[model samples]
Target: MKPICFLLLSTSAVFAADAPKPKPKPEFQYQTEGIQVSLPRADEPKVKAFGPETIKAAAKYLDDGAICWVREKTCVNCHTTGPYLSERPALARQLGMPLEEVLADFVKTVPAEVKPQKETEKDGIKYYGGSWTSIWRSIGLAEWDKHVTGKLSAHTERSLQEMLMRQSADGSFVSYGEVEIPHITTDFELTLQAARAVTAAPAWLSSLKDPELLARVEKMKAWLRNAPPKNDFDRILRLQLAYYMPELVPQPQRDAALSLLSSKQHADGGWCLRDMSALNDWHFKMSDTVVKLISGLPDAASPESDAYMTSFAIVLMRQNNVPVSDERIQRGLAWLKREQRVSGRWWMQSLYRGNYSYITYIATAQAMKALALCDELH
Candidate 1:
């Protein structure tokens, strides 16, 4: 018989101290785009799993990651699993849907006569003008409306180059388009996603040497080298850049970043947001963001952190070709196996206000991807 111990985990721990907190946002800014971009602040009366007891909590909470205020919810609301309709395809994969279908369905929302300014907002505001359309164009679906392959492609490529060109005098890339101001904080996470896009764009771009593109890449590299010290997301960007362009970053800095990540594991086996007060903005759940951050840990024994974190460690280890046979990995895997619901899904906390899909898909996808490497490791 499988030993089953049922534990209901709350996503937060009870703060023994009394402090007035702010009201939770009804929805995040991306709601119009149909995505859950942020979570509630800690000032809310939501119950969450804190400490080692998290394994048994029922309602797990997560922190919202947005720095700016928006009119919509998180990414989940905007990008449904329908073909040709969703705005963000990376998010569609989280919903386990066909990317083309998702794009086809979401592009219908774009207004006609897309302009560069309309497509990309100035600050934190949502980009309404065919920005979604432009993203799809990169993936070969740019002409979903009228000119899928013609003017839109040229426009998108030009727009991206322009975005890359306007690097901060200090070398960091600026916001892509018009957006809400002082609202979106450009953190390590955003930079990492940007790097991934920059790294992959060349393969998708018709030509690799777009002069403009190479210059932007160089500037991006410079900004990364000069990024604010102690920013976790910046560390991630640096690590990724080191992986992509080894000669650009010194090897010593690479070791230092990984060492920093490995050493920062809290006693509770989680990474808190940069500012303790930042927790207040995280949607009522802290664990969600914590686990997501755990994905960047560089520790060899990270699997021993906790069940949730360990799961993330296993996923990362397999992804990086690191051995996963550590005793901690076995124990963590065993614990998760026992906790798997009859639906075969691992339920934890949602970082934003939405369905369980966000955290579930990310965690599961990592696990699934790692499991594929198990055969190879054996």
Candidate 2:
């Protein structure tokens, strides 16, 4: 009887060991318009040929994606709708796309109160939902006013005012701190976007009459001038800031930032986010197993050219006076043109914990912006 019991237990253990494991949950799952929707997994398909029709398909994809996000989430996010507003306005007038609806959606995000109540705290800092939203709304509205209407709307002013109200005493704004890379991760990126917002609207800044608002702007400028960049990502942001607000970044520093960015371009004429900073530098808190599972590729320790970085690098270089005729700019643009997926979106692997890769949305937006700046999208 004892031998039979031992043999049965051993058989059970062997069966358990051989059982197939359950699959992991997808990184992104949500409902859109009363229907369950899961974002497609990120992948790099073979490049499609670029032509006039390519731009049209890309435009349709951008418009559909932005409107869908706004209707479903009804909130400003760093990944998709925010970047769509920031970059799409420039192309809308040229492409004859309808942007008023999307623009209105962003303006509605601004709170009516001058100083909204903080809703949460992270690492000892107070955070408001509007902290991140206001800055992005300001940027989006500023872009719309600059490129589309050529006049700042009252809502744009209100959004900027709300953004200013959320500013930290040190001249930076609080970020989501969700560890979402490239944006919503750090105070520096938020501050840089705030700078871009205000500088992009010179008329709004000059028209400011409120003494408190003026002082807040001064504090922000001082912080921008004093805050040191922690990595190459920050440096590229600084180069972008110099384009809009030259006073915050010295000419020599601006030149050095550009040189550093130029040096990081891959042989394929693209840039890799991994090359911008070490994994530790990003300050993520996920475990190794989770990282490997979500990334589902080679470790991020090695550099691989991606759409977000490539389009971002090209846009910043052009903004800072790099000519489209330059070989580096040409190659980078060529890479972008070659990499458009069949869905008309440029694919970028998300550096965040999820597989949503909504970063691809921004990547596509920036890709279009880069092409427009190079006179390829007209």
Tell me, by TM-score, which candidate is best: 2
lDDT tens readout by residue for model 1, 1-378 = 623431232334234223467556455322333334333221223223222233222111111111111122212121122112211222222223223433433333333443334334354533333322233233223222222222334433443443443334444533332211011224333333344344444343445576756765766666666666433534534555665556666868777755654454454434322311232232122344443443444442332332234454444344434466754445545555444443233443333323323444334333333333444111
| Model 2 agreement with the true structure over 1-378: per-residue lDDT tens digits | 555655656777878867997668654333456444345455646446887777887787677777777777788877777888888877875677456778878877766766644556666766565677778888988988888888988888888888887888788777654566777655677888998898676399888899988999999889878887767787778888888778778888888988899899999989887688755555434446435643566654565898888988888989988898999899999898888977677877767755566777778888888898899976
Superposition error at 376 for model 1 (Å)? 9.0
Q: Candidate 1, overall lDDT?
A: 0.37
Q: Cα miss at 96, model 2 (Å)? A: 2.0
Kindly give the number of clashing pairs for every candidate.
79, 0
Global lDDT scores for all candidate models:
0.37, 0.77
* RMSD in angstroms between candidate 1 and the native structure over all alpha carbons: 14.2
